[model samples]
Target: MPTYRAPRGTRDLLPTETPTWTRLERLAADLAARYGYRRIETPLFEQTDVFERGIGEVTDVVEKELFRLAPRTEESESWVLRPEPTAGIVRAYVQHGMRTWPQPVKVTQTGPMFRYDRPQAGRYRQFWQFDVEAIGDPGPAVDAEIIELGTRFYREAGLDGVEVLLNSIGDAACRPAYVAELTAYYEPHRVALPAIERGRLDRNVLRLLDSKDPAMAGLNANAPRMTERLCADCAEHFAAVRAHLDALGVGYRLEPGLVRGLDYYTRTAFEFYLVGREGQQQAIGGGGRYDGLVELLGGRPTPAIGFGIGLDRLILALTETAQAVPSEAGPTAVVVGADPDDTIARLRVVTQLRAAGVGSRAELGRRKLGKQLEAAARDGAHFAVILGDELADGNVGLRDLPAGTQKVVALADLAREIERAHAAHRHGGGPD
Candidate 1:
């Protein structure tokens, strides 16, 4: 026989860790709802072309991280475990004709997404994302609203010291000319660019603007900035987004070199990071404008903006800041000192407690009264109900473990008294 464990880059959230996830989900859901966003669900996998057309061909996700698989049928084409949810959500919107329902469709979802990347601390091959998207709006207010939602989400989740990095990649009209100028600037220093960056020089020159290699970073330091190339329309939109952020009192930094490293994003692109945690590999979450994505995915030209918060990274940030707390665990009630012959009575008590929505556990193995009390304390039980030959005389022993108090109550009034005590204890009104 062999012992098995969860695969690398994956984890099983045990009972002790469930409360963190539960708390985060609740906070995210409440924040999204307050912002007028509804919930949406999509499949875990989709046709390969969906991603190829939706996520850029030159992006790292498509080039290296996608989890590709073939369907069962011989004639069927390949499918991919969705590395992200935006494309799938767009596809659903188009397929369901959601365009006819409203001008801007607001939605959010939380689920597992797969990608084949080297797992490091806070990075995983399979992880959860809390994603929110707004489709069919091209206004700058929409962009600001999405960013605001993301900021509030982090604060609501108890994360502090987070900041936003904002930038505009320019609109379609101004981008081509800027791309040409950028290409020319890098042409002279092309030989100095890193091998990995050189390959993307011609195809995705903007990414070079974000190079981390010391050599490439030096070469790019003098390169022309994207802001210098923004067309009139893109410049106006960028200004409007900034105005909204300022009016709303949201502090942000203008990173001219902030290329989001994604293909579909245009005009507005931004990322959120925790201040003083710059060395952390992953951003807590980020999102930007993807106006052309829906059309590229075979739908109408629907403009949209959204963000995806990495649950793993967010948890890490929370831990580092000492904002996360472990959830308390215990059985609400324990049945103690039941003899083998008194099994029926013990079972009745256990069943009744459960039926009344109380969490109860019983001692099945034969044990002495003292041993039973020790077990109950070890399990963090609130109270112990003793059912033995002594309690067969129409009364039961109710022991309050914490207070060292014990009393005998009529068997008929046992359940009612337990319920009252439990309620009082939960509300902090019970005796010490």
Candidate 2:
């Protein structure tokens, strides 16, 4: 027999790594809420059309990466693990009547998204994202705000090397002309086009600008730029977005070649990358304005802007750039030594400390008090509440591991004593 393993494109996040994920998730949720975005969760799988219709049938996620489900029995409509969150968020907005609540409803969600692609470094078949969206607002200020939100989030995570590469992709009002010019530029050299890119040249010309085929670099470079062809309104919107970002002191560079990966993006499209002094170009996250997506999913026409921060790639960059990925906070105290004969009374105090909002752990069995203290130290517990001698006198010995001091605390006042110990630590006296 062979050892079973995680399927291709997937890997386990073991206990040692999960605490970092928890810490990052808590920070992300807090940052999202501080920006006035409420958290919302949607089903992991949605009707396949939610993505196909929302992300467009010709896009890579729909054409190549979607994981469609097989029904247990016939007659159920098809479903797929979500390739992204925005479409499902839009569907939820329409289905739950959140439309009537308020204009520009801002929401955030964090979870796994599945895409069946051949994985590479920092790219997985299953990935997690922290998605933030603001619906029903058309202001360029909102677009800038979304960008600022993402920038500030990375800053909080202690990632100071990220730089924003930005561009305006125009919209239906002006994109048609740019696409026409783009098509004309390629039609003349159609015979020279790579077979994979030829079909999309007509239906999705903008995608050609994003082609990675080294052979087409020349053609893509010469293709008409979207910024030059933007309609009056689109150009003004892009300018305002730029102005607001400058006003906030968020540094960004204009990368006219950046078109982003989605079909719904318009006007403003940007990607955040870890820019090293040696020219590192690892992109951590990106998103853009999708002003037409709401109506496409059955809700009234609404304008929206959002970005999904890739949790996996961000951590990878953290490791690469040597940024700190915080771990879960350590336990406040641990009960040291074997349980007393009156087990219920001794253990009850530990439970009571926990119920009263303290991080507490207990040691079981006849481990020597020495070994028990070692376990408490390994557990990162600040205080070792030793169950010894004083139990008969309704007192326990409290040892401060970091400061190396001890005190006799009344068993009835265990929680308070733990608090006093920490307070002492804060005030410089410590356990001494």
Candidate 3:
């Protein structure tokens, strides 16, 4: 016989960990609903081209991190586990004709996203994300709205002091000239740069600006900034986004080199980082305007913007800060079978109490009353219902675990008595 375990880069979320995951997902869904964003779910896998075309083949996600799958049949299209939701959601929008619904079709989704990258402290190959997208809108107001929504998510999640790093990468109209200037600046020092980064500079010069390579730091710091060369329209859009944030009282820093690692992103770009954790693996979520993605993905020229918060990273950050969702209340009452003959009576009481909205459970393993009560207390049960020979007289023992006190109550009044005790406890009356 051989033992098995979860594969590398993935871990099972056991019972002890799932409650927090559930709370976070619930919070994400609630916030999305409150923000008027409808939920949308795309397939777990999509045509490989959807990503290659949408995220750009030159980007790391496509070139190195995509978990590509083989064609199922000879005629089937190449497929891969979705690395991100935006591409798939946009694909759905195009395939389902969501454009006919309304302008700026806002939608949200939360699920697992796969990436074939090296796993780190907070990064995983198969991790969860809370994604939001506002399609068919080009105005800077929606841009600001998306950014504010991200901020609100963190604030409501009890994460304080998250700062916004904002920038403008300009659109196709003004970005080419800036890229040319940036290329010229870095061309002289090409020999000193790493081979991979040197190739990146030639292919996607903007990425080098946000590179983590310490050697390239000084060189990139002096590179031409797109914000300084933004076309009039882009500059105005950036300023408008800033004004919207200012009016909303959302503070931010202007990071000229903040070109998000996506080819489709244009105009405004932003990322949310813990105040002191900036410049580290502390960026929990970020996205920007993908004005060219729709057209690139076979849809008409539609402007859209969205962001994705890495749930795993977010949770890790929260844990590091000593913040967490409060532990949930456990079973309110446990129905213990004092003897084999009490099984039916115990089950009946458990069902009735549950139907009456009490979180009750029955010990069905034929354990002795003492053992059953011990298990109940370990499970955080507030009270224990002992079923024994008293059933003949329609009576039972209701033991308050926390208070270490037991009382006799009629069988029919067990549920009501439990409710009354709960109310009394809530009102500062000790367990009766």
**Candidate with the greatest lDDT versus the true structure:** 3
Q: Could you give the candidate ranking by lDDT, starting with the highest?
A: 3, 2, 1
**Per-residue accuracy of model 3 over 1-432 as CA lDDT, tens digit each:** 438877668888878778878889999999999999999999999989999998988988999999988776999889999999999999999999988988889999999999999987787889999999999999799998889999999999988888899999999999999999999888888899998889987789887887888988888777778888999999999999999999998889998878787788999888988777754567889999999998898989999999999899888888788787547567889999779456777788898999989888998777788899899999888889988778789999999999899999998898999988877786885432
- Which candidate do you rate higher for TM-score, 2 or 3? 3
Ranking by TM-score: 3, 1, 2
TM-scores, one per candidate: 0.93, 0.91, 0.95
Tens-digit lDDT string for candidate 1 (251-354): 89998888876688888988888887666544778889999988988888889999898988898888777777765667877887656446667778778778
lDDT at 240, model 2: 97
Q: Residues 1-432, candidate 2, lDDT per residue (tens digit)?
A: 659989888889987788678878999999999999999999999999999999988888899999889987788989999999999999999898887887889999999999999888788989999999998889799988999999998998877788998999998899888888888889988888889889878668887887878999887887789888899999999999999999999889998778777788888999998886333227788999998888888988888999999999888877776664544456889887445344565477689888877788877655677888888887778898888767789888889888679988888888887987676775874332
Error of 3 at 51 (Å): 0.6
lDDT of 3 at 292: 93
Better of 1 and 3 by lDDT: 3
Query: Global lDDT of each model?
Result: 0.85, 0.85, 0.88
What are the RMSDs of all candidates, in order?
2.2, 2.8, 2.2
Q: What overall lDDT, based on C-alpha atoms, would model 2 receive against the true structure? A: 0.85
